[model samples]
Target: MPAPKNPLLPAVRWALAVLAGAVMVLSFAPFGWFPAALASVTAFYLLLPRGRRGGFATGWFYGLGLLGFGVFWIRISLNEFGNMPAVAANALMLLLVAALALFYALAGWLVTRLRPGEDAPRWWVGPLLVLPGVWVLLEWVRSWLFTGFPWLFAGNGQINPLPLLGAPLAGWAPVVGVHGLSLAVALSAGLVVVALRRGGGARPAALAGLLAIWLVGALLARVEWTRPADGPLSAAVLQGNVEQSLKWAPDGVLPTLEIYLDLTREVLADSDVIVWPETAIPSFLHEVEAGLLPPLTADAVAAGAEIVIGVPIMEMAERYFNGLISVGSAADRYYKRHLVPFGEFLPFDRQLRPLIDWFDVPMSSFSRGEAERPLLQVGPYRVGVSICYEDVFPEEVRQALPEAAYLINVSNDAWFGDSLAPHQHLEFARLRALENGRPLVRATNTGISAIIDHRGRVTASLPLFERGVLTGTIQPRTGRTPFAAVGSLPALLLAAAMLVAALLLGRSRNTAA
Candidate 1:
């Protein structure tokens, strides 16, 4: 019945899968070789075996390679900042990586299990249709499942300038969002694989289709999705460059506040809007309102500017929120809705308290803000605000569009240290700017503070671990892109439809045989 399995074949496939996964990391920030993303996915697809178990094994190894190397910086936060033992932190990181790899293993298993019999007419169906759909669907699930770790996505790599190719396809972001671009990349990779296997007959069509997809993307990139609604305003983003080790220390509090306040004063004369990084104040708003607010508000009013700064807010007994407040303007307050698990607040606190206490993380008990909160009004413009990691979720950014003229995201990335995390985080922010057809101003505590235009291009930025102010003019856009209008619904629906079509096609072929 079954042919004898070759012992070396399994070893070769596993090795290829590992290599594919490791190489995929190069496609991300600090080393942005985007073409590698396609190649890595292609290599992984080629190694996947027909059997479901073998497919699972290959996928697991591949994911191990990708996330293991991609997110290695997590250890820095856990060991250096969380005060976890080096050995324990390394082990914990490994455990988390292995668990995340399960999602990829499931995707691989589904691809192999859903394939039609060998005699099926459409040999290209599995790679072209099913695999890409399964891959993107799982990525979407990974974004919100168990609080989500949406990092190092396929589309994030494309945010870097690609000469002709990047500038053109950049328009595709607003139509389908990052998940849709990932699907297109997978489809292109599939076409390349199919062309190699099926010989001359499929090669020309495959090549032509691949070129056409990119060409269309390039043409679409030329289209202006949104327009400026008002005159450009001078905005300044302040990077405090606070050290994570001393940030919450009793003696370090006032100095940290002074660092941001000094930087704000430097730019206030010319800036219409000034922004400070997350938790720049290092104290509750009420505690500082009497002393800090009066002077800051007076300065802003005298300078004829609006100031937005991040500070913690206490609402009820022991219930606090990570929030942003506007001064010398409409006095709007926006609280962060999405909270980071373990980092911002521990889930299942009673059960997990012991483990969390051992790690020694600071401010690990923030309550989430309401999702339907109003936008922050800065001077004449209505701004959408995302705190720290919230910009990574496309849906969160989309929720602020059409009404909010621009966006401001504040983060304290000092926790990540000297790693690729900051670069990757900036890339994610750029995509959000592209997706919503709105300008984005990102302020961080210790690096990658940037001014991104409506097209997702970084116009200016400050170096990492630098105490400085980035001043630039940002145009306020009024219209919404397709993504801002409909959100991820269209992309998710298309992925579902593709998977269903593949299943129906496979069943029909099996019945015929």
Candidate 2:
């Protein structure tokens, strides 16, 4: 591997790193340029310095570019909805982006520290095995650490159902989940960087290895892990398009209830089950039980349909939860287990309360539900329910599988407005469906409400910010995919093994030298 004749200056390299990170956003929703993820990561890999400090700096800049642009919607939620002042919100957004960028910096430092030197015989091992493993392991750590921000994974770009020249890339989802795909993407990028630098026999090997990974992924996409357990169930997903400003207002409560009730009544006759978005009701379940439940339950029973509605629930006055309840035929409830940090429950509230009181986020304080709660039964089928961002966690979704006939995710994406968050969220839902090999019925407020089949294909959908109902049929699947059966253990094990192999190979080469 020869050094460049005219190496880029430090300033130019940093700029390129930032540019590479920003370009990664195109690989996700709204743009859907899937190949850009590989290209962007490749650029980042090529920009990484041989020295540890320089590598960290390069990665930090890349992360700033990636997260700063990708999740800019956080500013929307803070400023527009949370009513945070522009300066404060922007500062907070920058702080969060910088905090998240540390993971990328750590990944870069780890790769540089562990990788073989430029002249080592096993230099190929670093890019092909070590870098991808370190990258994904750090990504996994970031997902759960501090109530993870698990967005913008490299595999997320492949969630689109569209195949590449007749090859379905999303097929790998059922076998390895998103982390494996992220690993593959990182490996490809690293290999590209290696091939570019080492123009020898290593070049062809790296290229061939890259092609093999994609080809295998395409072939894996065709494997069906779960099969239909029952006939398709007609479902009606209501999109009330409720405005965030008016949602909790004193006068708007009744109208909001009326909108959902009317939509349910309209679709009750034709649909087997009707799903409402997250927090569809503005008030507590007990408060509305006397006034709302009787009529709604009666109406559902009369139509021979089940109704699932989202509402806040008060448990013994002091404890409250953001909950979903199924009325009519099936009587069950699920409280959200994974609460969003700051958005749902503020962390370190005692310390931050003075500052936090400035933002006017409603129902921001809620208790997490018990993790071992039973699945909700709707008629003969057992339904796995995820509220809002819970769908993004593959392991969280897997807990209900094997027993769950299908999955239902209820969300209020109106918080994101017309940003890429909703579209990216929908993509997450599709990946969950593919991973679990279960059909997913998603009901969202203000857009991208959809019914996705086990294959991760959107069968039907409702447009964003529209007040309407989407009627679609979903086949209940009973079997589990390899992903569902083993969860992320296999992927984690593979990553660990690769890192071990890289370390051993690097050590052996150093000992010989």
Worst 10 residues of 1 by lDDT: 1-10
Error of 2 at 23 (Å): 1.5
Tens digit of lDDT per residue, candidate 2, span 1-513?
554643778788889988999998998877877888889988877787765558888889989999998998888889888999999989999999999988888877788788876666676777878888898898899889998878998888876543435424566789989998788888888888778888868789888988888888888877778887877799999999999888988787789999998898788899988999999999988877998888888888889899988899999766899888998876888999999988889899889999668877988989989959336777667888899989999889989988999999999888878898999999899889989999899998788899999888899999888899999998888888999989888887888899999989877777887
Model 1 lDDT tens row, 13-62: 88878789888889888887778888888887777875555888888988
Scored by CA lDDT, what does every candidate get? 0.85, 0.85
Give residue 63's lDDT in candidate 2 (0 to 100): 93
Best by lDDT: 2
Q: What is the C-alpha RMSD of each candidate to the true structure, in Å?
A: 2.2, 1.5
